[model samples]
Target: MSDNSSLLRVSNASLLPPLVDWTPPTFTPAAQARVAATMVLFVFAAISNLALLISVSRGRGRRLASHLRPLILSLASADLMMTFVVMPLDMVWNVTVQWYAGDGLCKLLCFLKLFAMQTSAFILVVISLDRHHAILRPLDSLNAHRRNRRMLLTAWILSALIASPQLFIFRTVKAESEDFTQCVTHGSFHERWQETAYNMFHFVTLYVIPLLVMSCCYTCILIEINRQLHKSQEGESLRRSGTDMIPKARMKTLKMTVIIVMSFVVCWTPYYLLGIWYWFQPDMVKVTPEYIHHLLFVFGNLNTCCDPVIYGLFTPSFRADLARCCRCRPPADSPRSLDRLSARHESDPPKAT
Candidate 1:
C-alpha cells in the first residue's frame, strides 16, 4: 500500500504543468503611443545635435568654434553621444516591452545612460568656466587650448567613473510574478532606503553641483562686465575708436549664458524632482506616473534642440554660417555685422601674454 501511494503521488505531480505568470501578449494603444512619442523625440534630438556638431566642426562655422574649440567640441560631442548611444537603447526598451537583453547588457545600458547625462552636465559646467576665463581673465596662459582639451578628456573619464557603480547595483529581474524582465536597482531593506539613497546621490551629483558652479561663474562674469563697461564709458575716446565693442561682446556672451542656464534648469528640473518623489514615497506607486515620465523625458531632450538656437542667438558669425548651411541667404544689407563678427572671431582666439 505504501509503494502504491508513493507511485500515485509521483504521477499526480508529473501530471501538473509548470507555473508561469503569463499575461496576454497584446500591444496596448498606450504602449504604442509611448513608443511613437519616444521615436519622434529621438529623431529630433539626433538631427538637432548633428547640425550643431556640423556647424561647429566645418566651413565658416569652424571659425566661430576655433575660439572655444574644446568646449564647443565637448558640448556637441556630449549631445551627439546621447542621440547615438543612449537613444537607440531607450527605443529598443520601449518597443520590446521586456528586458530580454539579459543582465550584462542591461547593466551596460544603465551605465551608458548615466555616463552620457553626467558628462553632458560636466561639459556645461566647464563651458561656463571657459567663458569666465575668456572674459574676466583675458590673457592667454601659454597652452590654454591644450589645457581646455585636457579638462574635456578628464570630464569624460570622471563621468564614466561616477556611473560605474550602477553596473554592480542594478540588475535584470522578473517583474513581481510576471513573465517579463525588468532592469532596475536591486532592492534591499537595511532601512528600506536603497532607492532613496541612489536617487539622492544621482540628483546631487548630476544636477545640484553643476548648477551651483555655473551659477557662481555667471554671476561673477556679470559683475566683471558691468565694472568694465562703466570704466570704458568714462573714456570718450574709447567709444569713438570702437573700443566699446569689448563691452558689447561681453554683454552678448552674458545673454547667451543666461539663456543656456535657464533652459538647462527648465528642461532637467522636473525629471529629477519626479525621481526623488518616487524614491522617497515608494508607496505612491499607484499614482499614474507614465504620462509624467513621458513628459519629463521629452522636455529633458528639448535642451538638445535648444543648444543650436542659443549659439545662433548670441553669435552673428554662427548665424551667418548656419544660414549658409541651410542655404538661406543672409540679409544682403547685414554685411557690416557679419564682417565685424568674422573679425572678432579671428582676433579673439589668441591673446597677449
Candidate 2:
C-alpha cells in the first residue's frame, strides 16, 4: 500500500512491548493529497481492470491463444486485487491516521495487502517468462498451456507463502499515553536490525528479483530477435517472408507486455527507493519533505491504472469491446447464428495468403 506501517514507525520510535508511547500522526495535507490521488487511481483501476477481465473472458478473448489467455487473465486478476485491496486500504488508512478495525482486521488486511502486491509482481514475471518461451521456442507452443498453468500455480502459492508472515508480525498496539491505537509491527521484533532485515527481504523479493528476471527475459528476446534479423538479411528467401522467424501476433504481444513491465518498473521504483533509504536511515525521514513520500506512493499506484490502458492500446479486440459498451451496440447476429456462420466459414475453401 502506502507503507502506513512505515509511517507509523516514523511517528513512534523506540518500540516497546504492549504499548508504544508516541503521538498519533494526524491527517496532514500530505496525507490528504495521497488520499485524493489514491481515490482517482482507484476509480480508474477498478473500472479498467474489470473491463480487461471481462474482455479477456468473453467474445474475442475466447479466440486468444490458449496459453496467452491465462497469462493475461491472471495479470488482470492480480491488478484487480491491487485495485480492490491496496487502493482502499491505503486511502482509508491515510484518512483515519490510526487503526479502528482492531487486531484481527489489522493482521488480515496487512496480509492481503502484501499478498496482492506480491501476486501482481509474480504474475508479471510469469508473463515475461511466457513471452520468452513464445519467442525462443515456438515449437514448444503445444506444451505452453501446461507449462503456464504450473507457473501460474507456483506464482500464487509463492505469494501467499511470502505474505503469510504478516499475520504474525502485525497487530493493534495502543499508545495509551496518547490514547490512540495503530496497527503496526511495533513490538514484533526484539531488535531494530531484525525489523530492517525483515523489510529488506520483502523489498528484494517484491521489486529487485522480479525486475531482474523481467530484464533478463527481455534482453534475451531482443538478442534473439537481432540474430534472426541478421540471418534473414543474409537469405533472399528469408527477406521475402519478412522475418518469419517470429510471428506478427506473437511480436505484438511481446511489445505490449514489455511496455507493461516498463510501467511497473517506472511507477514503483521511486517509492521503493525512498523506502529503502528510510529503512537504512530513519533520520532521513525527519529531513525529507513529507509530501515527497506521499507523492511517490501515488506514483506507484499509477501502475495498476496503466496495465489495462497498455492492453487496450495493443489489442484491437479490447478497444472494440470498449467501443461496443459505450455505444450500447449488440451484435447484429445472435450467438447461435454466429456459431453457425463460423462453422459455415470453416467449411468454405481456404483462401490464399
Candidate 3:
C-alpha cells in the first residue's frame, strides 16, 4: 500500500505542466498549410512585379528610357521592396511563430511595412490625379514629367512621416513558455486610448482618405471625359471623321483608368476592412487572432499580383513590351525593326500612362 501511494505521487508530479506566462499556440496542419500557401502567393507576386520591371527596362533599354516613367517605376519599386523586405519578414514570422529579428530590426521592419503601404496608397492617388490631368485637363499634360517627379517625392515623404510612429509603437516581447519573441504594436497606454488612436489613424490615413481622393479624382475624370466627348461631337457633327476618332481614342484611355481604379478598389478594400475589424474590441465580444493573421496577408498581397494583370490587360504597349522581352519577337537591333521603333518613338514617345 505504501509503495503504491509513492508511485501515484510520482506520476502526478510527472504529469504537471510547466509554469509560464504564455505558451505558443499549437500550429495546426490547416494553419500551417494556409501560411505556406500565402508565402507561395507572395513569392509569385514578387516574381510578377519583377517581371514587369524587367520588361519595362529591357524594352526601353532596347528602345528608349522615356517609356519607363517615374510613376510606374515608383509603384513597382515599392512593391519590389515589399517582396524582398516586408513579405519575407512576414513569412519568417509566420513560419517560425516568432519575431527573431531582435528589437531594433523589429522596429525598422515594422516602420518599413507601414511606409511601403502608405507609399502605395498615395502613389495611386497621384496616378489617378495625373490621369485626370492627362486626359480632362490636357493643358497640364505638358508638365506631366515634372508633376510625376514632384508627386513621387511627396509620396515617399508623406509615407515616411506616417510610418515614423511605428518606432515608438512597436516592440519585442518574449513568451515565457517558449524561447521565442514577437514584435507587436500597442498603444502608448496599453489599456487606454492609445490603441484607438493608432488604429483609427491607420484606417483613416491609409485607407479612408486615399479611397476618397482616388474616388473623387476618377469620378471627375469620367465626367469630364464624357462632357468633352459630347462637346466635341456636337461641334463636329458634320466633320469627315464625324467626331469618331477623338471619342474612340478617349474611350480607350477611359477604359484603362476604369480597370486600374476598379482593380484597386476590389483588391485593396478587403485588407483595410480587415485592418479596421482587428480593432473592434467591443463591450462583450472578442475577435479571433488566428483568423485575422491568416487572411490579412492573403488580402494585402493580392494587390501586388493585380497590378501586373491590370497593366497587361489595359496597356497594349506593355503587353508588346513584355512579349519583346520574352523573345517572342526578333532581335530588336535588326535594322528594319530599329528603324520602325525609332520612327515610333520619334513621332510620339510612348507616354507612361
Candidate 4:
C-alpha cells in the first residue's frame, strides 16, 4: 500500500512539472529586493495605522470623539481587511508558478480587494469634503452636526455604490504558461466598453469630482481664514490677542489638509497612471520575473495602510481618542482642570461681563 501511494505521488509530480518551476531566472535578485522593500513599507504602515485606530477606539477622551468613531473604524476596518484578505492572495499570485486557488477564489478575491480599495479612496474624499464644510462654515447649522450618524450612513452608501462594478467585471484566466493563471479582465469590444464605463465612473466620481469639491472647499476656507486674520489686525489689543489664536488654528488645519492631499496623490497617482497605461497599451509593459509584479501589488496595497496615519496627524481629538482606545495611560486631566490652571496664572482683575 505504501509503495503504491509513493508511486502515485511520483506520477503526479512528473505530470505537473511545468506548474512548479523553481529556476533562478523566474524571479531576479533586484526584483526580489524591490518586493521585500515594498512589503516592509506596507507592513510598517499597516501596523502604525492599526495602532492609531486601537488607541482612538479604546482611550478616554472627549465625548465629541464619538462623532469620528464611525469614520475611524471604517477606515481601519477597510485597511485591516485588505491587509489580511488582499495582500496574501496578491503575494501568492505574484510568486506562484500557477494559480492553485481555482477560479471561484480568483473572482471573489479580486472583487473584494478592489472594492475595499475603492471604498477607502471614496471615504477619504468624503472626509476632505466634510472638513471643508466644517471649517469654512462653522456657524452654519449643517456644520453644527458634522458628526451626524446619517452622514456616516451616506459615506458607506456612496462607497458601496462606487465599488459595486468591480464585482461583475474582474475575472480569472489561464495564461500562456502551463502552470500559470492570472486574474485579468477579458474585455471584448463589449467588455472593453464596460471597462471604459467603469473607468470613467471611477475617474469622475472618485478622483475628478472629489478633487474639484475639495479644491473649492479648501479655497473657501482659506479665504475665510485670510479675511478673519485681516480683520483681527484692525481690532483692539485684547480683541487682536483673541483673533491671533484663529490664525494659528487655521495654519494647523491648512497643514493637515495639505498633507492629506499630498499623501493621497503620492500613494494613488502611480497606480492610476499604470492602470491607464496598461488599459491603453497592454503589451508595452510586461511584469515578468514574478517579483516585479509582486512589488507593484504591494505598492497598490500601501494606500489603504497609510490613511489612518494621515488622520492621526491631522486631528488632535482623534489622536487622543486613539490613545485611549489602545488602553494607553489616561490624559493628564479634563478641560475644566486646564481652565482652573489658567485662572490661577492670571494676575489682572476680570473684565465686566
Candidate 5:
C-alpha cells in the first residue's frame, strides 16, 4: 500500500493540473533560448525594414521611383510596427509568463498585434494582385499612382477596422489560481459566443478569402505567362530566331512575386491551420509542453521580417532608392532599363515581311 501510494503521487506529478487551477510555469532554460532567438530576429528585421522605408520615402519625388513608393513605404511601415511595437510586448509576456502590464495595455497589445498581422496579410494579397495586373495587363490604368495610393489607404483603413473586434474580445483576466494574471478572452456564454463569432469571421475573411484570392491571382498570372511565352516563341519561330530576351526588370518582378507568395505560405499557413485546429479541438488537443503554441507565436511574428526582404528582392526602384538613401551608387544596370531598351526594340520597324 505504501508503494502504490508513492506510485500514484508520481503519476500525479507527471499530469498537468486542471485549467482553473493552472499557473504559467516560470521560464525554463529552453524557453529563454527561444525568446532570445525571437527577439534577435525581431530586432534585425526592424532595422532592415526601417532602412528600406527611409530609402523608399526619400525617393518619393522621383518619377521612376514614384510607382513603388507607396508599396515600399506601406510594407516597411507595417513590418516596423510589428517588429518594434508588437514583438517586444509579446516577449515580455513570454518572459514573465504573466500580464504585469495593466488591462489597458493588454487590450492595446491585443489590438495592435491582430491589426498588424491582418494588415500584413491583406497587403500581401494586394501586392500579388498588383503584380498580376502589371504583368498581365501592363497597359491598364490600375498601375496609376493616384489609384494605387487610394487603394493603399483603403487597405490600411480596412485592416484597422477588421482588427477592432479584438479590443472587445481580449481582456486581462485574473487567473483562478489567484497568483497570476494573463491576457485572454473571457466572458459569459454570450460573450464567449461573440468571441467565437469574431474568431470565425477573422479566420474566414482575413485568411481564407485572401488566400483564395492570392491563389486565383497566381493561377491567372501563370496562365498569362504561358500565353505570352507561347506568343513570343511563335514570333521567334517565324523569323527563324531563337528567343526574345525577357527583360531583367520583369524577371525581378516575377521572382519577387514568387518569393512573397512563398513566404506568406510559409509564415502564416501554420498559424492559420493551428488556429482553426485549436478552435475546433480546444479540449482534445493539449498545447502545453508540446510547445506548439510558442512555435506558432514565433512564426506568426516572422511574417513581418519576411515582408521587407520580399520587397527588396522584387522591386528595382526600391533597391535603387535604398542605395541612394544609404549613400551608395545604384547598380549600374537593371532590368527596368533593359525593359526600356526592349520597348524601344518593339517600336522599331520590322524587316520587310
Candidate 6:
C-alpha cells in the first residue's frame, strides 16, 4: 500500500496542467480562402501601383500639372506599402497561426501596417482639399505646388506619429501550455475598456474623420461648379466672350478623384462597421461565422486595386502608357508617340471657344 501511494503521487505531479491554457489555432477552410484571396489582391495591387508609379515618374504623366503629380505618387506609394507590408503580414500570420518572427519584428510590422493605412486615408483627404482649392479659388493656382508640398509633408508626419503607438502596444506573447507564441496585444491594456478605447480612437481617426472631410470638400466643390454653370447659362455675353468658368482638365481630375474616394468608402465601410460590432460585443465572435470577417477584410483590400484603374479610365495618357509598356517600347524616345500623347492630353479637355 505504501509503494502504490508513492507511485500515485509521482503520476499526479507529472500530469499537472500548465498555468495558462492555449489551443493552437487551426487553419480552417475560411482561413485558406482568405490567404488565396489576399494573394490575388496583393499581385494586382503591386502591378497596378508599380505601373501607375512608372507612368507618373517617366512616362507621359510628366505632362500632368506639377501640383497633381505628388498626390498621385503619394497614393501609389501608400497602396504599395499596403501590398508589401499589410497583405504579406496577414497571409503569413494566418498560415503560421503563431508568431514565427521575434518580438522586434512583431512591433515594427504592426507599426508599419497602421502607418500604411493612415497614410492612405490622410493622402486622400489631402487630395480632396486640393481639389477644393483648385475649383473654388482657381486664381490661387500659382501657389498650388507649394501648398500641396506642405500638405503632403504634414500627411506623412501625422501618419507616422499616429501609428507610433503600435511600437509599444504590440508584442510577442508566448502560450506556455501549447509552447507557441503569437503577436498580439493581449496584455498591453490593463483593463478591457482601455483596449476598446484605443481601437475606437484609431477607428475614428482612420475612417470617420477622413470620410467627413472628403464629403464636405466634395459637396462644396459640386455646389460651386453648379453655381458656375448656372451663371454661364444665364450670361450669353460671358459665353460668347470665350471664358471658361471652370477648366475642363480640372473637372476630369475631380471626377477621377471622386471615384477613388467612393471606392475607398464603399470597400472599407462594411469591414469597419463589423469591427466596431465585434469590439463592442465580444461574444459576436462566437456567434458570427469567421468567414464573414475574412471576407470583409478581403473586400477592403480590393480598394488598393481600384485606384490605378480609376486613374487610367480618366487619363488618356495612361492608356498609351499601358500600350507602350505592353509592347516593350522605349516610352520616352518615341517622338511620334509623344506627339500623339500630347495631343490626347490637350484634347481631353474642351476649349472654351
**RMSD, each candidate, Å?**
10.3, 5.0, 10.4, 10.0, 8.1, 9.7
> Which has the greatest TM-score?
2
Model 1 score (lDDT): 0.63
lDDT of every predicted structure (CA atoms): 0.63, 0.79, 0.59, 0.51, 0.61, 0.77
- Per-residue lDDT, model 3, residue 342, is 28
Query: Model 5, range 204-261, lDDT digits (tens) per residue?
Result: 7667888888889888877876775776677743433222333344445556766876
What's model 5's overall lDDT?
Answer: 0.61
The runs of at least 3 residues in candidate 5 whose Cα sits more than 4 Å from the true structure, single-residue gaps closed, are: 1-20, 59-65, 188-194, 236-248, 284-288, 314-353
Ten residues in sequence with the least summed lDDT for candidate 6: 1-10
lDDT agreement of model 3 with the native: 0.59
Looking at model 6, residue 35 earns an lDDT score of 96
Tens-place lDDT per residue, model 4, 125-228, is 65565556545544342332355456666766776666655555554545333444544444422544455555556756655666676677677777866776
**For model 2, which pairs clash?**
none
On the 0 to 100 scale, the lDDT of residue 267 in model 3 is 67
> How many Å off is the CA of 39 in candidate 6?
0.6
**Of the pair 4 and 5, which is ahead by TM-score?**
5
Candidate 3 lDDT tens digits, 1-353: 00111011111111123325644645555457656876887878787788767755555323322322565667678777767766676566556656677889978888887788778778888777766665565545546667778888998999999889878767676545667665654223445455656667877877789889988887887676576467666774344242343333334444655676676678667655654554453221133444544565566667777777766564445666666667797434433222234224322422332
Q: Single out the weakest 10-residue window by summed lDDT for candidate 3.
A: 1-10
Model 5 TM-score is 0.78
Worst 10 residues of 2 by lDDT: 337-346
Judge candidate 5 at residue 73 and give its lDDT. 71
lDDT of 6 by residue, 1-353 (tens): 00111011111111124426545667778889999999999999999899989988888777777778888999999999989998998898778877789999988998998899899999999999988987877667778779999999999999999999989987677767667776667666666677777878888888999999999999999898777777767784365322245555676677888999999999989878876775577566667777887888889889999999998877766667888878855435443332343334323433344
lDDT of 6: 0.77
TM-score to native of every candidate shown:
0.80, 0.89, 0.78, 0.70, 0.78, 0.87
